[model samples]
Target: MEYRISEPFTKEKFAQLKAGDTVLLTGTVYTARDAAHKRMVEMLQEGGQLPFEIKNSVIYYVGPTPEKPGNPIGSAGPTTSYRMDAYAPVLLDLGETGMIGKGQRSQTVKEAVLRNGAVYFAAIGGAGALMAQRVESAEVIAFEDLGAEAVRKLSVKDFPVTVILDSKGGDLYSEGRAAYLESRE
Candidate 1:
């Protein structure tokens, strides 16, 4: 089923989502990649303030290209998610509620999601240009030295995503495959 979800996700809102559900997300989504993750984790370790509010916020794992004339952002697309696995649990423990990216997360991250009542959404891979259109606005919010890998604050309206992992421990990556194999029998 499809649902419309907003940023700064609440426990009640996320609890309704299950793996395999389609969602149109409308609100702010911060962009961050591997380098940014490393920095954030280091900052957390040092007891430094994060660039943005962590509680219930969504972070999109993307490194968008330079914007063309008349566009809010360039080819904004999800990068591999596993690269952030090392830092995810730490962030989740601090109240991060959502992540948008491509591919499966590590078991550690999946467990963290359940532990923290968070959800992981999979944005369509290889659809950068299409994804960029959904972004209403984008601006560098932190880590400017990282260029495309810089942290960006994006205002997205009706951005499409699918629930890959939900707080209930529902996982589409494994469940989908299981269903497909079962159907062949």
Candidate 2:
């Protein structure tokens, strides 16, 4: 079933999501890709505060393209999730509850998600142009020197995604493939 969920999801809200569920996420979400994650992780290691509060936050793994005239953002899409695996656990442990990206995550990230009551959602690949439409506002929140890889704070409405991994350790990538294969019999 499709759910309309707002950002800053609590543990109770996260408990309601499972792998393979469709979600239309609304409200603010932060964007960061490889470079930004590296910087943020490094900053944390040095005892610095993050640009935004990590608690109850949802972060999208994306590096949007340059915007055209009058648009809040450009083609915004999910980047491969594994690239952020090294940093995700730290954020999850810090109380982040949701993620939006594409591709499979490492076992460590999956474990972190389960342990921290977090969820991972996969946005459609190659749907950048369409996805950008959902972003109502965008501003660089940190690391502006990184250009397109800079961290961005975005306000989104009905941003689409599918739950790929849930807090209970459910994984759609493996289970969905097996289910599809079984259906062929």
Please give the RMSD to the true structure for each candidate, in Å.
Answer: 0.9, 0.7
Q: What lDDT would candidate 2 get against the real structure?
A: 0.93
1-185, model 1: which lDDT tens digit per residue? 99998766776798899999999999999999899999999998898999999888899999998998998999998999999999989999998899999997898998999999999999999999988889999989999999999999999999999999998999999999999999999
lDDT of 2 by residue, 1-185 (tens): 79998856787797889899999999999999999999899999999999999998999999999998899999999999999999999999999999899999999999999999999999999999999999999999899999999999999999999999999999999999999999999
Each candidate structure's TM-score, on Cα atoms with residue i matched to residue i, is: 0.97, 0.98
Q: Count the backbone clashes (under 3 Å) in each candidate.
A: 0, 0
| lDDT by candidate, in order shown | 0.93, 0.93
The candidate that achieves the highest TM-score relative to the unseen native structure: 2
Clashing pairs in 2: none
Worst 10 residues of 1 by lDDT: 5-14
